[model samples]
Target chain A: MALSFKPIKPLLHTGTNASSRWFSYIGLGIGVLLLLCSVQMFINIQQLLKEGSIRKDGFDFVSITKNITNETMGQPEKNLFHADEIDAVKKQPFIAGVSPLLANDFRVQLSAGNVLPFSTDMFLEALDNDFIDTLPPNFTWKEGDQHIPIILSSDFFEIYNIFAPGQGLPQLSKETAMGIPVQISCYGSNNTVTFSGRIVAFSDRVNSVLVPKNFLQWANKAFGNKERQDASRLFLKLKDVNDPQLVRYLDAQHYVINRDKTLLGRNKIVLQGIFSGLGIFGLLVVILALMLFSFYLQLVIARSRQNLELLLTLGYSPQWLGKNVSKQFVPVYIFIVLAALLCTQIMQWAFHHFVMFDRPELSSLVNWMVVLLAAALVLMAVVTNARLVKKLLHGLG
Target chain B: MKLEIKNLLPTYFEEERKSTSEIWGKERSFSNGDLVNIVAPSGTGKTSLVHFLYKMRESYTGSISYDGKPLKQFSREAIAALRKDQVSIILQDMRLFEAQTILENLEIKRQLSPYHPQERIIEMARQLGVDHRLNALAQNCSYGEQQRAVIIRALLQPFDVLLMDEPFSHLDNANAKKATALILEEAARRKALVIFAELEKADHFPATHLYHL
Candidate 1:
């Protein structure tokens, strides 16, 4: 027959200090709950912030330029990005890709011939096709093509519409503007060349009159003062908009980008700091609770020291006694942690339903990392309990 | 199995006192199935000799070895195994869990090694006149009854050597005779060695060898 512990149970006085044992249990449960909740909340906040700023194209693009401060205001070259400076920006870990906006070096004029009978001097810029928001099939040009296609900025169009009525010019809709053809004349040092220009698309991404990169390059080479010019602005594709390194790098270089996006990044840093502080506080609570449990274990063993010595004298190995004594508390540790996990799950579900209110970013259940941490905590408790019991029993020997 | 004791003397004994002893300051050997008796008055280190053989205390000057291996060299687990399988003892003080009943005390030892069947516990208790007191708490029972229970507890396990330290001090002549009859019967059944220690020789126990401590 197997030796039953029923006879041995009464020998060791583990039932002493009933209230203190329960207090430790409650403290452990609360500590576990606090830790898990902090982790879950951190994950939820990160998900919500990430979802709020994600672009429709699933890529973040920011336009950056050198600050035109009072010291460098009159020197145009200081505002332009040199080749080495562009390479340095491209080398940043946060930036996935970089594209420079090429500006026209020669003079250009846009004239509505018979439709509106309006003409204006304009600047043109071109960038890589990958950086362009809208790409129509005809937005391309070759060496022999006489027709030029252009993408106008929606903001520029809106500005023109707002002032057209007061200036005695007819306001045009997008469809009406696409139906009209205008003449673009490029003026060089000795001659002027004319081409028929058509509006192909409007972009909300870039605030410029954009043409094909190849056409701009050819035009600058043929009817320009110089071969190439430095880029005045750069469009950078970033991996994460909230990357603090990007903001710090930009600040160190005295560069400027969209303020609205950097403001969100700054808020993320502050929120992350707050959540990390809460997590550390929770961890401290867990450590304190574990120390309390260790004291309880020591009290029980110390009270029963004589009985344990007799048990060891009766050929009951210290190993056996240690294993059995530690086994008694395994259920308590597992139950406390599991109860905390259930509470975290309920809170997450309520948070998702009532607080977040179907915000598609967060889930209704706790994250898997929280569950793994709870498991790790249980293992830690069991191992610590066993080691302490073994040490105390070995002292008796 | 063999037990070898070489110049064993309790540390409390002075060096000049070693010359007046037989088992102390002299080499001795005990083998399997060799029944022996140790007779000595009180404070003569009879209990100390029992403890030294059990490896319970190390306050001694000389070495004691079991089966060619020294007792002090055994690990905790090895000592536990030795006590559980090869050696059993009835201490001068009956070390029973006082809060537990006599039956529980006997059952704990019986279950530890289980040399005898469960029915044998009650049968031996009846022979030693402790059957009626089996359910009584050890502290509540008389010393004579508790001593018989301790004997039953010691005989419940398998052993090649039995160390008894004044085992019948509380028992009357009639009760002691019954307890000795049961112990000798069990020892003879196993063909085991019995090392019985007492202040005076009991005519009932047939020891093959005798020693004066």
Candidate 2:
């Protein structure tokens, strides 16, 4: 019987190749997943920031005032911010725009129908209409309009609900509160004028009762006060309150931030820092995994060096042998990328459905960015593996 | 084809402290069908001579050529071609992969050129008394069995020259005779030159010439 020549399998290196190749895929898969999720989370946070609704504490705006020491306390007028100080604050690189907090020059009394039935003293604050994020429709007023639109602070209702229950007064919802008409009496310089005020919206950004800037300006002039409006509070539009230079500038000016607003601003920076830290950690894991993979490749190639030399002596070209060595890793690279992409997609679905149930606009799974990340990982694996294999083969050859 | 060695000297042999031998600096030549026995003592350069001829060691001075052409002038591709098609070697260590079976070790050579039929390989293995251990790992075989396996593997390639370094060092008389017969059969079929190194005279192996190292 005629027998055929048999081709031999590499028995010496097969055991190691089978056992070690999966670890590279697992490590790379984890690294790719971590990096993809972090980048996805970053995109989600950025989207929330853009929508301006996720910020429970306002970060896009800052409130500043002159430092009130014991000495300045005695002279209340001296603690107020001046024009040049406001200009100087505006000159700071972080400041995008600056608006002074305008106050009504008169005292006011409000009475609801059979509700309060008594005149309660009230003060009014105003800001530019463009600054309020939740400005309701028809929130502005003209001189001929009798009903003045008001944006009540959420804090005011929190305080009212505390006491209104004990007083036997019916608790008011925001809609019911908006419908209840109130009579306002403004008394300043012995001249009294009454205006009808109705609640239009509630504000979370600004912490005081808000009237339209146009209404405030009209009321201040009509109430018989004609003076250079000196503002005691300043609302600052900041590009980024986290900027160190802005912090340093504020510190040097002996100016104080509104404690509530400052805390919110700092929280944003801390949150962003945490996200960035996660991104860096993911990158480090990838680098470490890559190094480990390279080490494994080197070891496998080295262990088989004798066999490889024998093969070369048997007339096998280095390129042919190197290609055979590298071919084993190609499947691993493909599997890693596919597994990572699948994992990221699963995570995205879970996050979108469970974590972000209310926010449907955000992505639920692996987006374009995750795909790009997978592509990048595949490229890195191929290029790095090719280079290492070539170098090892060259050394052997 | 003819192989020529002229004014050949290993680099370390030129140093004053070492023993100098005439064969280290001698000119030698080999042609087709010439079975040249290199008989020498223990410290002679028998293994080095085999290594140099296989192009594994390049630390020797002087010229080595094939026919009339300098071997140094051959490109890497050409040298690889020559190794596959013209020259074959049975190393002193056998160089058989210990992890592979006997037949698989033979296939390493057989598959490269696909020169020998499997029937011929099986017949050769039977003649050497290793056909039953063909599927056994080379490392598990006895020394004589492995030596015979190496001889069979070396003959699987087509060659104009066969370099055997202590090829039968571990073989008994009967198995050595069998291996010598197989080597001579292949050499005569190809009309090839066989240069073999041995400590003592191999009267069983017919040789046309002999050189003392």
Candidate 3:
């Protein structure tokens, strides 16, 4: 005949604290639900953050400069980044690549000869070719080349258009501007030189007059002051623009960065903190519920001590008693966990459908990690209950 | 199976009691099919000896070994196994789950190690004159009825040795006679050893060996 625990059930007398037992079960269910929801929300937030951001060149290319403060007034050296500072920025784990924006060490004047009659003393900057958004094939120069190619910032053109009509000049389009020939006058300490410059392209990234690196190097060497100059700005390519460590590092060094890039990083830190707090709170509740259940177990076992001892004396092994006692709670634990998982799935579905408006970035189902955590929780409950029961039974022995 | 006892004396017993005891402070052996009777007055540690032999207590001086394995050396699991399949006991108090019915009490022992069919419980209960009280809660039954039920419950499991501590103390002459007959028949069926510890020798039991404690 198959052995049955029906007779042994009444011998244990676990039916005393019905209210406390139900309270523990309810607490366990709520704890599991909170933990699973926290994990699922964390996954959802990560997915949404990853898919929602826009990238111009498949990566964030941001320019950073030292913050100008009153303490460093009239000190140009403090405003510039030396080679060591550049190397340090390049060595950061979040930085993929770094290139300094080399500024013209010479004075320059530009004028469109007859098309717009515009002349101004302007600063020119150059960096690595990879950092430029638009690089035409003709935007290059060699030794002793007089025809210079220039890329002007789109913001500069917009500002020029705003003031063009008021200044009694023609409102030039980008195509018309690209065809205009301009004169570039360079002044050195002793001599002056002139080159014909043409606008080859417009850049939306760099907010300064951009020239080819080779042209800038040649011009600065031949017609510029003979003094080494540190870079005032650096263009950085980053693996993740929202990396909090990058923001922290830049802030620690008193460097100014585009706040729009690290805004998501700040929000992510707060979101992660909230979710982690929730997860920890859920874990504490789980532990407290288990402890309460353990106390209930102790009460039951204590009350049934004599009967259990008699049973043991009658040849029932402690292992058998423990297994039987713990087995009675297995189904309850599984039910609680599965119910919590179901609740989490519904919440995720609702979030994906109602809160997120059916976005493709987030799934309607809870993450598989939540399921794994639920399984682990069930195992933990079973193992804990069995161990406590065995220990108590062993004490009786 | 063989039970060996050497220089066995309860640690709580006075030194004067050991000199007159036959089972304590002496080397004794009981083999299979030996129906032994130990007679002792009240406060003589009769129940303690039964407990020691069953490995329920360890506060004793010498050693008791079952099949050359010392009883004290038996782990909880091993002792449980011995109780389930090798040794059985009937306590003087006739300990039972007070809330459980007499039939349920017997069913627990029978399910642990079933030596007979499920119907044998009812049949044995009937033979012991407690079949009518099988469905009643053990706490509600008379002491004599509970004692008879305890005998039936102890016989439900298979055993090579049986320990009884004043098992028939509550039963009257007729009921005690019935219980004794049923216990001896069950013991004989397995060719098992029976150690019946009591305050006085009952004339109904045909014991092959006798000792005084």
Candidate 4:
């Protein structure tokens, strides 16, 4: 048997069907609600994670370090450490590795007596030869060959051309701990420096330069130290990123993880647990209200379908009747999705502005979930409407 | 138009009344293009007779054979074709849709016959003087217009029998004569059976057969 096409029924006009109008309103409403819920969930989860991060890692111990005030490096005061001082610390149990450094800040004159200040603050840091055991590998310096060999920073080339205002030529302040001390004044006409450092290492960071302990002693002698420590500061290494030992180590080292301003201050485990209870209550309220609204709108749409019965009576089959009814649901579902998505955004804004003291960034996951939920509801509503239309048809027949 | 009804009976069922005998009758014969006047007031089961004759529907007992085969032997699609193409009806209440325009209402009638195009609709409207009110909505149209529109729609198809239930109840004397003449003319032209629940306004027929229920 072969199937033949039936004559086409005239298309319903745009905005003509009353049923479509009802479905559109309902679908739009449902969509907006879902979108809003998703956004809320996103913001809530993000806030939870942010607060959690503060609670977990907000208290790291930092040992007070000082010694090599050698200014060859911009912050040579921060470089030198004492291994003997580290041994005196009660946090010796948590010790990882101790590294000491020497630094200098001075000017160097190139060929032709054109003396210029070397603005580069070079640092000579010495590791325990096992700094890798404590810090990650990518952060450690690997250099080959000693004298005449240098590890220049990425900004080393750039710093050479920098000019100081109101100064015609660069000048050097020769700091001497033991080596030859000579003061040089640069006249801009004859001062030109050449780049001769080996590119053993480079970093995008321009703050500090690195060298071995052997060179550090030379630099310390060249630039002179304000004060030298008895031993290096301790750099404790833990098996995991988070360890309770960090808190005790900070106490023994007289270090502190100040949290009165950061996220850690506001978060107490008990307080968050209470907030979670409130959030759950809020969720239940939303579901009940939204589901009721959805069911109400559905019934209203069902009543409008009674007017379409004459078509069915006039030889239109049930299946075609469903298609006719589906037109009503399409616009409604579209409206619902859009409205719900929009509502979610509004709610998220409101949550940040009014509800939460700390405005957490919205979660992408929650946003998408809201979208997905609203879409699913719209689809379900359409199918429900069609089924209702069918039941009505059977009743009329 | 030809039909065959064999041992037909109709019943109305209700929870309170249980079941009541409606039309306990049977028919077996072949009549072609006969102008029939089934003169039963309302609810004398004239619709039941026609319904059973065209095809035995729900709550109706006995099989109606169309052109010699048992109606039960026919598939749903086949019965649908018989109703849509072979047999057409003008419902008693006019059944004009409230949602459609006057032109649309008639167009639905025209659509019953796939072979007849829109040109035939213009022709039918012209003959019935409904061309002037082509754009008016259906419910807004006068009762007489609805009656004429329905009859014209039934005529649009090459129906074997045209079943009309008081299709001209609303037409006045002059328009009633015109509508009757037009309906009879089209029925005679096609040599189709025009079965109508006759009204006082129905024009006199010289040689037409009458069934006074």
Considering every candidate listed, which one attains the maximal lDDT? Answer: 3
After superposing candidate 4 on the true structure, give the runs of residues whose Cα lies further than 4 Å from its correct spot.
A1-307, A345-367, B1-3, B12-24, B29-43, B51-59, B64-86, B98-101, B108-115, B135-142, B156-161, B171-181, B184-194, B199-213
Model 2 scores a C-alpha lDDT of 0.77
Q: Return the TM-score for each candidate structure.
A: 0.87, 0.62, 0.93, 0.49
CA lDDT of every candidate: 0.88, 0.77, 0.90, 0.51
Candidate with best TM-score: 3
A226-305 in candidate 4: lDDT tens per residue?
A: 33443333433322213334444544544433433223323333344454555455445444544553454355434434
Candidate 3 residue lDDT tens string, B158-210:
99999999999998988889889999999999999999998999899998999
What tens digits encode model 3's per-residue C-alpha lDDT throughout A140-248? 9888889989999999999999999998888889999999999999988898888899999999988889988888887788778765468999999977777768878
User: What's chain A's TM-score in each predicted model?
Assistant: 0.86, 0.58, 0.91, 0.33
Docking class of 3: medium
- Which wins on lDDT, candidate 1 or candidate 3? 3
- Candidate 4 Cα deviation (angstroms), residue A320: 1.5
User: Residue A213 lDDT in model 2?
Assistant: 88
| Model 3 chain A poorest ten-residue lDDT run | A49-58
What is candidate 4's TM-score against the reference? 0.49
**Candidate 1: segments with Cα more than 4 A from true spot:** A66-95, A103-123, A141-148, A179-197, A214-232, A242-255, A262-267, B6-20, B24-26, B40-45, B59-63, B199-203
Rank order (by TM-score, best first): 3, 1, 2, 4
Q: What lDDT score goes with residue A146 in model 3? A: 93
Write down the worst ten-residue block by lDDT for model 1 chain B.
B14-23
Q: Write the per-residue lDDT of candidate 4 for residues B127-179, one digit (tens) a residue.
A: 77888777787778888787777777666666677777766677666776677
In what order do the candidates fall by DockQ, top score first?
3, 1, 2, 4
